[model samples]
Target chain A: MSFPKRIIKEAERIVSDPVPGIIAKPHEDNLRFFDVIIDGPEGSPFEGGHFKLELFLPEEYPMMAPKVRFLTKVYHPNIDKVGRICLDVLKNNWSPALQIRTVLLSIQSLLESPNPDDPLANDVAEAWKEDSSKAIATAKEWTNKYAK
Target chain B: MDSDISTGFTTDQSFDAFEDDGYDDLDTNSVVSVVAEEPLSYEVPYTSLSHEQLKQRFVSSVNQIQNLCGLSHEVAELLLIHNKFNIEWLGERYLDNPARTLQSIGLDLKYADYSFAPRLLPAPPNFLCAICCDDATYPVTFALPCGHRYCASCFKTYLRMRVSEGDIRLNCCLNSECRFPITDSVYKLLLSPSDYNRYRDQLIKLYVNCLPYLKWCIYPDCTYAVECKVNQADLDHIIPTVECNDGHKFCFGCSNEEHAPCICRLFAKWNKKCADDSETANWINVHTKGCPKCQATIEKNGGCNHMLCRKCGHEWCWVCSGPWSEHGTAYYNCSRYDEKSGQEARDQQAKSKASLERYLHYYNRYANHLESARLDKKLYLRTQKKMTDLQNSTSMTWIEVQYLANASDVLQHCRRTLMWTYAFAFYLERNNNTHIFENNQQDLELAVEKLSEMFERNTSELATKRLELLDMTSYVSTRRSLLLKDTQLGLLEGRWKYNLSN
Candidate 1:
């Protein structure tokens, strides 16, 4: 089947004007699939680290949001092990106007300010809630160990 | 005689003559209580509306809203749909703040003016579609009121996906920030004719699903909707058994087959309970008897009267569970009645046994009647043919034999009432009022069995027995009303004094 033109345009635009600290490049074999890297936001526990993620545009692209998962492990309450993030824009908040560029930026900012209140990982959130400095120390340790 | 024989032959109803069925063990005289109250009467207030009637009512209501609100039919429908199709609620909301109510449902009336141009103008030359970013020629792009243009192909794909998602509301501009909703007129001009039909169907389904009084007909493969015009306030006190135009009967309140006497709440609770653990309860009741020693339930396989409780290791006769030496298998007499077992021990045994007996009694009757009702329904077709035969063979018109149909209907009603009464009795505690209720139940049971026996007779006998069938049907109907009325009273007035543990 012919690829949807909107996806091709979004892919082209992502390559033309790359967002700072975020790199997204579509796969050579499948333009709908992309490999992305996000630089950790400064001063965050994840700072000085790089996180790899994968994004796939389903056949219902633009109408349905793309499926994204983190390939590199990170310590955060909202992002579960196996890298499933619980961000609203990735789900019901998504709209056809949202493109690869805007989505990656949202994920990058999500790393900087993690909301432990509505978290996907209970143990991580509980640890963060119990002691923030201690939890951030563990996050920093994990970032250096796995997300390097 | 051949036709009469054929009627009985074709009918699969395994009903037997009342005298032949050896149920005379039921003590009729003792069961009928001496209660001389006024005759009971109940009106199952319901009707079946034709498909055309349902449509006419909806169309008129839509038109009324359109004229009152000075909005298009689709917008009025959307407003009503958002408000759960409660037109009164819609009117009150509209009266309070019209624009806010419309805006809340994603409609901006100002955009309606943009749709005045009857036709969509094609895209300008060298125009780039915002969605696809395609350098498309004129006639290949469609634009909404917000001036957000996308290639026609892209717009169609987006609309198709959204429609399939089952939210048939109007589509908004593709741009995330644009709040302008596309008008139905614009959609019709852009979409292909077949897609347009699907879009309208989805819209109609959305309308029907949200409407407070409209429900899709429960009949399989039927697309019609059943509309009930009863006052919403009265709906709580009444169970409207609506028969859709396609001959599907369902309770308006619960969308289940008509369950009279059992209110929708109780009916739902009973269904959930039955679906949960009824089969297991039935198996235990049928196959197991409690160990006389430890009170643990025990199932007996191949064994004589002499037995031993596996848990307690107490040796006793299975029949009376007395001392092992008391059993004499000489003639299969297990044991003699022992007065030595203290009254306290005997009383506890009697109490538990009585509870089990009560449950088994209700459950068995309930299951039996349900099975009978199923068989009777199968008999209806054969009875119809038999009625025709009787009409042909005797000096009777089609109308004269139509009593057979009425008899079948009355029988079904009695069966359903009897089935639910068991569920009612299951929850009820034994009280003075329960005596009268049980008497009423017995009366209905007798009448149902008699009518069923008559129904199973040969056509010649049935023709000759029309008067008996009619009389039995009326008796069944009256007794049913009494049981249902008394059950309802017991439920409302708290006469049963429900034993929560039971």
Candidate 2:
């Protein structure tokens, strides 16, 4: 399917905005690769440090969800150490009407309140499932140590 | 023939004999006399309870009926029937009274029970009241959903404050989410005979028939005190359920919209003409409400969840769909405080504060100097006047004695002189206080005079220089008054300046 103009415009906007928790930057002057940051929301264990992720908009945008993956090595239910995201919007739950802006926003919310019931990274998912406190502390320490 | 005559028929043979004797011409008075001569009456009429005595217990349950006559005819008849069927000796009580017209029933007083209505008091008996220690006749009875009755003033104030405060979620007047508000109509029913008597003493009293207009919304979802104009026809009572708060009566209908006939028999006919025909009606069952921005068709799905753009591709949450992701579909993003912007604002404030402090310092320096110079000029004039007064001698006191020994009230003069020196010292400190250097010499001389006077021993040297400056100052002033060229006494001020080393 052909890429919608609105989708391209939205992708451009997300990159331009230096969001606090999430940083979105273009890959080598192209609209395709966006390196974004997701600071955990306040009052949560993931708060204070940036969590970097990659946003690769497909040629056929809006009609298909963006290819969002984590760049930073992290312990989370949804994201693996190799920058793979396990969100429905990025996977089988992808809808044709969804756009790049919405995809990034949903990822930010996921980082704020991670759901471990459906695991993307099995080990991290299991730890999150078994002991949520240890998982949150580890995630926060990783943010301070790596994502300065 | 004799038996027929016993019944006042005089008999058949007697009639034949009369016809033979021409008795057809007998007088009417003689006929009454013949009938009256027949002996005593035997039929005794039955009696029933008097209308007034029995009516005392009957009160119409219907509001309109009781308002018109003291008692409902239906209830009155039931009272009469009860007396006839259940109580004995009621009939004889008022057998001769005109008001005992017929029984409450239009039957012979004996059969009144068959035709009489059940005697019902206007308000149900159990709807008395739950709040008071004793019912106290419940001056302000308010019916609630649990069929419990509470003081009307108590509940009305609570609900009014709650509604006005926009506590729509607190739908129940009893402060329970499960309980619905009592209906105004049922509240009126709670207005028993004794309630009217007590209504006068309440803190917040309700007027007659005003309770219905005091309609709390019928929407179990929203029992708000709806303004009649705004509510249109959606007004309801405080309690939506029955066996009202008092647990006395149950409204047979009106629980939900599905129940077409409500328990109160109070129903509203909704005309869905506006929304029914429109394709995009907001309220699924009612009329259409268009989108605010585009005037496009709008519809609310079962939940406040889904969104579809009819025109602008603008999908949003029904709750507060105000630009979540600019053009995104999810309502997850927040209106970030953008601390970076706050940092910029704080930086601006700090910069202004630094500049303002510098400005205030400049004003403080200049303000001090201006005040000092003004006071010094006044002190210079007063010293010249004192020198002139000392020169004049009117009394016979010797000059040597005035100058030495007892001296002219030296203690008092010393005190006044010390005060003047202190004032001069204050001015000198003030003038030298500023960073500017042009006024330093005058300030130093003034300081020397002020400090030198405080030490009376060996102060002779400072005092000799002070007297020298004073004589030079007076010479300049007198010469100026004499129209002579100005003398150079300003140089003496430079010479008398204090040496910091000393």
Best by lDDT: 1
* Collision count of model 2: 33
Point out where model 2 deviates above 4 Å.
A1-4, A15-20, B1-502
Put down candidate 1 lDDT per residue, B1-502, tens digits, no spaces: 1111111111111111111224323332112212222323222333344444555666677677777777777667656656766777788778788778878766665532232342456677667766666554646677765677777777777777776676556567777777666556656776678777777676666667777666776777876666665555554345555555444556777778767666666567667765687556656655566777788888878757666788898777655556676554533555454545534555555666676677667778878977877886587787788888899889987656766776776787679778877776666677777678778878888888888888889888888988777777666766876776676555556566555455
**Tens digits of lDDT, candidate 2, B141-237:** 5444344445564455444433343332213334222233332233234345444223311211211113232232234433122212212233221
The per-model lDDT (C-alpha) reads 0.70, 0.39
Give TM-scores of chain A for all candidates. Answer: 0.97, 0.83
lDDT of 2 at B232: 23
- Show the lowest summed lDDT stretch of 10 residues, model 2 chain B: B483-492
How much does each candidate deviate at the interface, measured as C-alpha RMSD after superposition? 1.9, 27.9
State in Å the error of residue A20, model 1. 1.7
Tens-digit lDDT track for model 1 on A10-127?
8888899899999999998799899999999999999999999999998777778889999999899999999998988788666677888888989999999989999999999999
